[model samples]
Target: MSRRSRPVVSNRVRRFFASFIFDKPAAAPASVIARHRLLNAGAYDEGSGTINGVMLIAVAAILISAVALGGNFLVCVSDARSAADQAAIAGAESARDGDFDPCIKSRLATTLNKAALVICKVDEEDVTVKVAVKTAVPFAPLVSRMARAGPVECS
Candidate 1:
């Protein structure tokens, strides 16, 4: 068999290849890397970063919508509770004044407070009323509140 001679790699090429492949891990001169984020940048589409940003925006929008809906629901609950308390107070006053039906006045009070009086009951100079308030939310959910007021009892 005839012996063949192998081509020798120059020191410069060896260093360049080493730096390209091994990241020049041995404190290589940054210049040989050639251009800061210029060429290798094209190797990747960077679309993943764009997708991540879009996903973040969508998540933020959903969170904001939830917060708004929750806030509206809380307001509706408070309004309903207030309306029920006011209606019960009005009914209690009517009972003290010897009204045959305090529910009629309670209905008027609930209406003035932007709520619908669902039920009213009177027993032993005590008045109890249930009221429902509707919110302007997407499905217009109603918040219901019940309150009772009676003459003060002292021992």
Candidate 2:
């Protein structure tokens, strides 16, 4: 073949193995080197695509779990608020009716709701209640709700 038609090799291998002095084999033609590089690039792209797919699935799963947890927490909050309101109203009505233990009436009102009363305050016909319920979440420290009720004394 004519010298002009022979493939030329650039300084690629020389840059990567600068310290090695062993007699290297004959350099491959430029076309062969380019083909090898393209094959490696395709393999790299395939591996990258697979990794990205797995990561996307994992992230989507985590996001779905978070949304479900938020919904459960909202239910807990709603139940807690209901318990507080009913307890406060019961306490106020008991006080108005001259019950011996108005706080006992408030406690009885929350019996079926599975809520624990943190505190109950009575001042004349007004009553306030603070309640809490256990949550099915991890690392939850404090979640409570408060409510107040009273009969308007027009005197």
Candidate 3:
């Protein structure tokens, strides 16, 4: 006897045919449904969502405030550094130009930049200066910076 060949079928096609022939589960009794409802009544309560949202908003606001304060402190520090450098350069230039007192000009420069001259030292044509800028933040110390400027000697 000659064997007849069968056509190949994909698993997807088999599953598609099988879906229409599955056994259905029996319906639950009314007592079981009531018990399930009673057991899960308090598991999904819904009053804390508002509280959680308010707490998240408060936390985000606090983070934004902290970042703003940190950025302001950084700007104050940069301003202090610039004031010191300008004062040092002024002192050095006065010394090179044969002025009477280089420190006086340095002090005036720092004051005009909203900073106080902390220290001034001149060694020949080189000038070193330290300046301080007061911060608006309560309980924060003054920002201080130091700088030196002089004419570079050619080799």
Q: Which rank order by lDDT, best down to worst? A: 1, 3, 2
- Name model 1 segments beyond 4 Å from true: 1-39, 136-140
| Residue lDDT tens for model 2, 13-83 | 56435435655555666876898998987854667887999999999999998888777788989999999
Please give each candidate's TM-score: 0.68, 0.69, 0.66
Error of 2 at 105 (Å): 1.8
Model with the higher TM-score, candidate 1 or 3: 1
Backbone Cα, N, C clashes tallied per candidate = 0, 0, 0
How far residue 45's Cα lies from its native spot in candidate 3, in Å, is 4.8
lDDT of 1 by residue, 1-155 (tens): 33456677888778767887976556545764654454576735657889999999999999999889989999999999999999999999999999989998999999999899999999967999999998767776788999999799899
Candidate 3 local lDDT, 47-148, one digit each (tens): 578789999999999999888877778888999999999999999999999998999999999999999999999999999999999876555668899999
**Ten consecutive residues with minimal summed lDDT in candidate 1?**
35-44
lDDT of 2 at 48: 85
Clashes of 3: 0
**Every model's Cα RMSD, please?**
8.4, 9.8, 13.9
